[model samples]
Target: MESNEPLYVIPERYRKIENLHIVFWLLKDLCWVMLWRPLGLVMIVPTIGAAALITWQTRHIKSELLHNIAVFFWIIANAYWMITEFFTTDDSLRYYAVIPFSIGIVAIAYYYIGLRFAIKK
Candidate 1:
């Protein structure tokens, strides 16, 4: 981490516990996606790597970090829904994914807006 960055540190022992929470949530979403969408297999490895990142970044950081993590999973879940719908019903449910995806985008905007304008210098 940069020495001058606004960093938060978690207790060393709690890190493992916090990471477990991240893994459980990430794997749950990924497995659900994998069950319905074959294309999800392509992301298995990358998702695990990303889960680690989510865990690390979210451990002791502000709520904004958790918001970002939620955004990622929301997008992943939407992609899974879209991919499965594409393979199963020929794009019949593709439009339904717009809801969660839109929500994810909004969450991202909020997170950034908070970071840029809400925090004091």
Candidate 2:
């Protein structure tokens, strides 16, 4: 059977959904970076290390569910640090909060790009 057809046609609904997803992801990243950048640089090492560990583990586990679980914990840790910093007026609390927030940013990126793509596939 030989068929002649339109080469490129996207359904309106799918296009809208995809566009919304892209916008949401971008907004999420922007918020995280804006809110966390100061702390992010300070904790870069651990953030990178955690991400590397997640990437290596995902290869062996091959489970989206597990990856999602890791991502959840990463987000929580980050949020906790942020909350702690916001509530505490003490100067000493500043340094301790950076690690969690930085790692959280890395985890957010990983999930937004990697895990989300994997699940879609």
Candidate 3:
């Protein structure tokens, strides 16, 4: 039996940007791991920019919007934690990264707990 649900396809441009975002994210992390502060800090611009762009592009789709928003927050939290490690010896400040991390979690939770039920209605 054939299912009736429509296929969802991402545009090629969006897909290309998403692939590039991964490269930026990896470079950012690699820089952090190597203790290369300048490059790591620079990489934050493009990495966060790409994530913001992706979230904007997906805004029309509730599910994608929620998840991408979470991703945006996740990248911010990761970058902030990396910066803390790069600049300071105080490990406690790194805990502040939890703010963005928690936002991401709330976005996901809202989707799963709130939006999911709303969609079913």
RMSD of each: 6.8, 12.4, 1.4
Q: Give candidate 3's whole-model lDDT.
A: 0.98
> Which ten-residue region of model 1 has the weakest summed lDDT?
36-45
Off by over 4 Å in 1: 1-6, 11-62, 65-69, 72-76, 79-83
For each candidate, the alpha-carbon lDDT, in order, equals 0.59, 0.52, 0.98
Identify the candidate with maximal TM-score.
Answer: 3
lDDT of 2 by residue, 2-120 (tens): 67975554457545544553454344445455766445434434443444444453454435334544554554455445445545667576566556555656656677787879899
Please report how far candidate 3 places residue 22 from its true position, in Å: 0.3
Better of 1 and 2 by TM-score: 1
The better candidate by lDDT, 1 or 3, is 3
Tell me which residue pairs clash in candidate 1. none
Comparing 1 with 2 on lDDT, the higher-scoring candidate is 1
Candidate 1 structure quality by residue, lDDT tens digits, 36-74? 344355544455455546646675665646575655657
Best by lDDT: 3
User: How does residue 37 of candidate 2 score in lDDT?
Assistant: 49
Worst 10 residues of 2 by lDDT: 40-49
- The TM-scores, one per candidate, come to 0.45, 0.31, 0.95
